[model samples]
Target: MKAPLLLHVFPGFAVGGAQVRFAMLANRMGPRWRHAIVSLNGRMECAERLAADVSWERVPFAAEGSLPQRLQRTRALLRTVRPDLLLTSNWGSIEWAMANAAPGGVPHIHMEDGFGPDEARGQKARRVWTRRLVLRRAETVLPSATLLEASRHLWRLPEARTHLIPNGLDLARFAPGGQGGDGLPVIGTVAALRAEKNIGRLLRACALLAGEGLGFRLLIVGEGEERAGLEALAGELGLAGRTRFAGHMPDPAAAYREMDVFALSSDTEQMPFSVMEAMASGLPVASTSVGDVRRMLPPEQERFLAPCDDVALAGALRPLLCDAALRRELGAANRLVAERDLDQDRMFSAHASLIERLLMSRAALAA
Candidate 1:
């Protein structure tokens, strides 16, 4: 029997959640599926995160130029790969749907993890119309309930072709460690220093706590375009020494273990992997109310504040930091939630099974 061929297309292979998820899926699926990744822009940073044994491709198409040139490049790449199935992600690669609309008609699957800062809380009609037209022939994969609704209601996609597949995490790698500081409280957040992540809010919140004479250190892990601005904000807020920006740690699990509390100040999200990883690391989280966060977190742990509100965020963080017993209880509950739903083995197996089923169904239709 021949192995199935799956080609994944993205805007760029950077260190984002979607890229990480794809790498994990490719590594875990192993020999059963042959994989190739094509990024519109030439950044292959996330490719390094893939398992050493997995064979993949990194095709870069220049994003600038006339529409004809762009479409021509996309069509050429599709013809070259001749994949059994073509999977494109988000708005950036939606153009691939048009490029792949040839006679043999390779099955197209488009995954929408979430939106960027430009369309954070709502849908853009122009983009939605384009999606409806370009994605009409493709099967849509929505990773969260919020996205599922967006596809069905906002984009008006057909129910038959839209499928919901929740994002999963690696439980074993993120498990809690007993080793950490026992002195002043520590609050931490792990994410790219992007504007949408709202790291500035976290800095301000920490500064407010510092003003109250509560000694706590805020550790931010990950790096991006907003690093310099965030660093400046910390200094401006008089949190220069109280906030530590750890730029792009190879393994964030150690940082999570060191944290007494976890924080997520994103202005937008849909089932963020960082929150799940923190919960798996057995830390209590105080995050903004965005996407399905209120639904994903346990009822007791659901202290969803408005995005970038330092006062509200400080109010939420105070209880978690000041009360040790509550922290232990919340952490234990979070661990249980992670074990029950976010185990990587289970996640990998679920994705493998879904892909197998998709292939089998396509074969039967062809027959």
Candidate 2:
């Protein structure tokens, strides 16, 4: 009885939500399943975050000359690995679906977590056609109901083949009761410094609160291309001393512990792990009503405001920061929600069970 092989393909294996989820699944699956991670861009820092025993490989995508050359390289890799199941995520690896299907058609699973700024609002026709063509043979996995519907109606995927598996939080690592440091109120957000995250909005909101004579510090964690621009914006808004861009912290849980209130000002998101981690750390969140965030949060802590509205965000932030008792109450409520629904072990079990079921059904069909 040979152990099952699961190969996961992604744009990069960096410290992102998808990578974290994959690491959790691979580590917990243990010896029963062999896991290999393929990062198209050769960024495997997140692989280091995985458990020591877990095995993985990094394949850099060389987009040098022609489309055929790229396709050839992808096919060669698929042939060499010959994985039992192929799991590719996002737009960057959609082409791998075509490569997997080209040669003997492996049991490919395409997981659509969300999209970037280009297709943030909805799926474009070109992308939809490409997905329908490339992903026709694979089963689709969507992490949010919003994405599930997009796959069905927008990408025209069959309802039978689509599975909705929400992202889960690690309760132990992100548990509540961590103490805040001695300082003015701290409002923090943990996300990649990408345009979609809209850290500028958070900065503006902080400036508004500060201008109103509130004593608080703003901490923006994580890093990306927008670092310099955001720093300049903070300075321009007269928040040079008050706002801190912490870059990429290895342990964001520690940062979450220091914050009086957590905030996410992303223009687009689908079940952001940062928010879940914040909730698990017992921090009340104020975020834009994007994706399934409203559904994921408790009613009291849902505080979903319009994205980029500094006034509305400022209004929301004042109560959470000034009212100590309110913050504690909301924090307690959030932690309870996380403990009840977002435990990492339960998430790992659910994913493993789903994979097993898929494998069994495929085997039965082959028989």
Candidate 3:
């Protein structure tokens, strides 16, 4: 018998957290599973990370239509591929949820990473109902406990069908104890400067830190549509000399070590990989209390968690950035939390187990 086929649908396959997670799971699971990826907008930048031994197919979803027509198109493809399982991600691919409900559609698992800029405040009534209705039959997976709650209470998803699978990192690869910068303390963050990421607020917060006359360099890693706006904001805030915008780099592990402190200023996130990577790099973190971040960090570090604004985030950053001893102490504690709880082996195994269960049920029904 051939290995079971799992079809993955993503908004785009750039080197984002979701795409990276798919590659990690596929690479580790190896030949035991055959995979197919459908990027709605067709950016396959992360495909290069997949191991050669994995059996896979990559086809950009090259079609345009209204939402209902898109569902019909995806439904037709579902019949053609005849996959054992269909894994759809984020709000962008909710059409697959509709597709899987069609006759002869595959069993599906819909993964909700987080919301786009539009739904930043809360889910709009239309999309909320679409998710509630379309995702009724599928197992909805969320990495954030916060999202998990939202799914159950707000979206009215069945508690039994909702799954919380925290995004995990390859712990050994991002291990701590590397050389760090000594010249000036570095306040760094690795995020595309998107509207939802709220990098502008972070820059303003950096300016706040500077107003207090702290010695630091704000290293803003990654690039996106909001980059120009952020650069101009930095100049306006007099952070032009202090902030360094390093356009997207493939590897962030080395850069984590170069930071005296790590930051996350996002308006929303569901277990961001950068935070885990920072914790694994043994760097103290100062972040807004978004998603499961408050629970994600060590108990003592919770005080540094703030609301989503420049002043609030700056207030959180001040204490950690000001005291070198506190930074060292918190960094050690964060690394221990990563080692104790956030290992990728656990995440990989959890996903493999879920996938295998889905495949086995499909096999049983066929038998």
Which ranges of candidate 3 are over 4 A from the true structure? Answer: none
- After superposition, the stretches of candidate 2 with alpha carbons farther than 4 Å from their true spots are 179-182, 360-367
Number of clashes in model 3? 0
lDDT of 3 by residue, 114-141 (tens): 9888987788999889888988788898
If both were scored by lDDT, which would come out higher, candidate 1 or candidate 3?
3
Clashing pairs in 3: none
Question: Per-residue lDDT tens digits of candidate 1, residues 106-189?
Answer: 788888888888887677889999887777778888878998998988888889888887778778888887524578778999
Candidate 3: worst-modelled 10 consecutive residues by lDDT: 175-184
lDDT of each: 0.82, 0.81, 0.87
Global Cα lDDT for candidate 2: 0.81
- Which candidate has the highest TM-score of all? 3
Per-residue lDDT of 164 in model 1: 80
TM-scores of all candidate predictions against the true structure? 0.93, 0.93, 0.95
